[model samples]
Target: MATFTPTKPRTIGHVDHGKTTLTAATTKVLAAEGNAKAIAFDEIDKAPEEKERGITISRSHVELPIVSGSGLYALQGTNEELGEKAILKLMDADPVRQLYRPFVMPIEDIFYIQGRGTVATGHVEQGTIKVGEEVEILGLTQGEPLKTTVTGVEMFKKLVDRGEAGCKVGLLLPGLKHGDVQRGMVIAKHGTLKTYKKFEAQIVYVLSKFYLRTADITEKVQLPDDVKMVMPGDNVTATFELTLPYPLDHGQIFSLREGDRTVAAGVVSKVLS
Candidate 1:
């Protein structure tokens, strides 16, 4: 018996080039060989417009079994032409394991222990942190990054020596008073984070009224003169100017709220100044 890896192969070419038909035929052949359960001709194109014009106008995903290692693979080009060597090469070139992101924790709440000093609590947005490592407090005082050392880390009321992305942990910062840190300040590895006052973002699902909320501060967004109001499902590139600087990075997500309700969201595309 041969081991198989689940792969999603994409077909790309000019329109009306039988891409859908080719995908349908591949599924049929795999089903005939007892690899796949059934053909997916109808599944490839279910939209009314696609059936009328016989062309795929949107993206579709289909799973096919390929003989390879245990992990999933995204096979490009012709699936039938991919051999064991090609599959192994694709697996070796996997970009997921090569990424290295720095530690970033946005302070949501702060507390001062009577004996230990200031404790900043927030979820680790990315990367990992260990005790005794130095971190910078950003977005607090304008143009100033406060350097502090992580003396201890606690999570869920238990002391921990290290923390990683997605974990809510409280870092013990010595020599800092309760007044030094505030909500919305980001604790990050020194020199890894930067403060920005203006940025470009792609806004979508625009509600009737929305304000950009970040770091416990809410600011109303001013739109361009030509645009009156942003509607739902609108994808527009807009520039945001903040009254105060924020520790921001590309690809960071922020929410658009209307009063007490969150109406939309956007991702930071580029940071300007």
Candidate 2:
């Protein structure tokens, strides 16, 4: 079978923002074209509260066809009634993209165990990790990636020889210190990941205070559209500079957050070299 790249989409906004309606429309259109995955389009609003209130009270998943890609794409219709923090939890729990690489784990924290040397903790983003496997740490500093080896793996205080993506665990690395690597860094199969400081993305409309931001400055920049300020609903393609280098891949879904609210969400389209 020919391979197809998958793009997962989510409808985001405040309560009663029509997230379900948009998702249903996409599902209906896909079903008309003989796509079986979209047949259960109405299931998204299956919650009793949604039917009674005519609002989306829970999340839904469907495989809808993308008019441009001509392929079925996984779409998530999020619960419109969720608060900012709850919404973030939903996003992280059911993240749009799935890991398919050899091994990809974004570092969340790093520390030195009493005797275990340098320990980095994070959930495996993709692929499988095994003890004694050599890996590379990306986005720590510019230039080439920092090379290291996995000396130990522990999940919930239990020793494990292997771990797959999404499994939360701490990995032990020798000859490294907590100061050497920190959060926002990525651990992946050697030579398989790239880091970036700038990228281009397709931002979907939602509750946002600022879409364009300046590096290390509180002043916000004018969007390419030149709008005085972006509001709760608007679509714009804008280039953004990451606060720190990241290994975010193209077609991956992410969100712009502040405090507890996610101001906006988007898909990484082009990696700006």
Best by TM-score: 1
Show how many residue pairs clash in every candidate, following the order shown.
0, 1
**lDDT digits (tens) for residues 126-162 of candidate 1:** 7888889999998747768889899888775667777
Give TM per candidate.
Answer: 0.59, 0.56
Q: How well is each residue in 111-171 modelled by candidate 2, as lDDT tens digits?
A: 8877668888887877988889999987746567778899888765667777766567789
Q: Mark the regions of model 1 whose C-alpha exceeds 4 Å error after superposition.
A: 1-99, 205-214, 220-222
Could you tell me the lDDT of residue 178 within candidate 1? 59
Q: What are the clashing pairs of model 2?
A: 124-166
Model 1 earns a TM-score of 0.59
lDDT (0-100) at residue 126 of candidate 2? Answer: 79
Instruction: Report the error of model 1 at residue 212, Å.
Output: 7.6
